[model samples]
Target: MANDDGMTYADAPLRLGRSLDIATNRYQVSGAIRSVGANASLPTDTTDVLLETGLPAVDADEVTVGDQLRIGGQTVATVETINAHATRDPNQHRVLVGLTLATISDGDTTRFGVTPVRRGNTLSLATDEYELDGRIQRVGTLEPPGTPTIRTVTLEISEVREDFAETFHAGMTERADDETIARVTNVDVEPSTLITTGDDGSVNVVDHPINRDVTLTTDLQVREATTGTTFKGRSLQQGSTVVLDLGTTTIEATVVNADA
Candidate 1:
């Protein structure tokens, strides 16, 4: 028998074997699981499972939090969050889905299904509720690895209102859900240059600067994840953009530097 994709049953074993090899080689660094099936069970004893997919950019938007995952008319899990990762193929982006599973059983498979959820194995899942074709990437607690630490990050705001920049001072904070996410420790503002191009294709900087370049040093909780250091759920790395809300105003700035 063959599936719509023209993949026959004979191809299953080869695909599964290849996926297992890929998973083993990339497990530690990539955190990718290519497939799962009956011969395997959950790698760890946990209710939280992380699924990975290489969904087309157009269809990726269909995944969201609170989406129900069902099999055979039985809802087995709920999507808690979605994280995207870039890949060499721009058309197909990789995504990680954090799932919270409810009680489920399939013979010896027990909580997950009839098969042991291994690192790499193709697992057929229902798509009636949420159209998803994912392989189990991880089976363990989804919480942050360890306690967060205070880190100082410097950001550069290319343009800002002069008045706002003057009034913005240290001790101001950005919060989410009433929890402080970042606190400004220092602020520096300077005249920003304006650039213009002539008809000859010559680039020039205007003599009179109209904008202010605001540099801010902020302290925030930085947590480590399997991927890397993260601040406010985003990759905390140089050249990344971060948005800070100071109650009265909001500012988006590019990270200039960060303390390791």
Candidate 2:
């Protein structure tokens, strides 16, 4: 992209635009993408991207670090920093954003199941020809002396990993046990703990007070009425006890007055 000055420079090389097919809700911006490993002495899987775009003076504060950017296709990047270039160049009034590529898959020892892929979670990077499934190893930002007011955001992204290699299946039922079942009274009372299902289908077992009533069902799963986080059970005896195990968390509730 060319700066405001008549003099042109080939600094920002890669195209940084929203991939409507991958992330329709992504913010529209333009810049370049570069691999951080270009200067690496060792191998790594990550890349840094620079986004220099015009923003309204009023909404400049809206953009901040930690904001996610859909770099290209399903590959999402995290904002590392936002440079206004006020001190470096007084003329070029644009946002020099720094971004680091996000990872395709992560590991969590406490929980299992394909690292919990949500609907909107990135699956792979899409290109005009094909898609890429890679990992981001490192990311950072830098600024060299220039007149066009260009900020270099470096990233060490590795595409060596095969596309769609890692795979996992949700086998939480195999981890279920009998201890997760318990009995509690079903009344117009609030429970100390609650479990809810996120829009992405991820289970959220947190401590929140919620009221419940006696709506007996033959096959009752451990569920938080407020969030709809249902945990499958083995021996779900409705009138006797409730069995619910969400893998990450478990709850046992028994009705003191079963008929009530």
Candidate 3:
């Protein structure tokens, strides 16, 4: 390996300003330069960026905190912490994390980058700006016996997508199982006024004076909008009001009469 600025690695690990060459990506040490985190929305410094791409299993050392970082050829930020796992799977061995990027790290730099490779991965962290620029160190590989690793294991928050369907489904095939389905029969959905009965057995207020009877619809669907699956409601309604019992939160819904 060749040095970036007239220097070479002899024996004892390495010091600041050394570069780590994993596959084709070069991690240059810039400790002499100040890093400014370019992240926001968060109120603290807690972001973890993992570089799980193009890294060799046997030749990639784990990352540490306070290391100025770069990934995917972009200056992401500084690493707040390094999660090391002594496992056979090189990918799971390390998880480069960037918990938060809101608070400044008592310096002046901005951004870190993460580049993923096939047989291995690179985990890097970044501050709100970039506080790990010149503070990056070359993460070396593990000692003998471990195969040079390669693969990509990166997880990022894509974005807040909208106007999508929400669904949750799990497929299961089983035998010798008793299946049961329950339904409510006495409940009727009719139009009625809502009244909260007072402790004295009297309603606190009759909000729906025109509603004589009520029907209730209390069904909840727990799922991600991006997915495709929903939970239908099973309610008991009398007129336009329905009685719902959802754990701790309870709400009363009135039926809207269509053109009768």
User: By lDDT, who's the top model here?
Assistant: 1
Q: On residues 54-121, what C-alpha lDDT tens digit does candidate 3 reach at each position?
A: 22323224344565544456443554544322223433222223322323233332232223211133
1 against 2, candidate with superior lDDT = 1
How do the residues 85-106 of candidate 1 rate in per-residue lDDT, one tens digit apiece? 3344445556667777764444
List lDDT for all candidates, in order.
Answer: 0.66, 0.33, 0.29
The C-alpha stretches of model 3 lying farther than 4 A from their native spots are 1-62, 70-75, 89-92, 99-260
Question: Candidate 2, residue 111: CA error in Å?
Answer: 31
- Give per-residue lDDT, candidate 2, residue 157: 14
| Worst-scoring 10-residue span by lDDT in model 2 | 149-158
Model 2: how far is 207 from its true place, Å? 77
CA RMSD of each candidate after superposition: 11.8, 25.1, 21.0
Tell me how far the alpha carbon of residue 149 in candidate 1 is from the true structure, in angstroms, after superposition: 0.9
Off by over 4 Å in 2: 1-44, 70-75, 85-93, 102-142, 145-260
Candidate 3 clash figure, as a count: 103
Candidate number that wins on TM-score, 1 or 2: 1
- Give the TM-scores of the predictions, in the order they appear: 0.49, 0.22, 0.18
Clashes of each: 10, 17, 103
Error of 2 at 155 (Å): 37
- Candidate 3 has a TM-score of 0.18
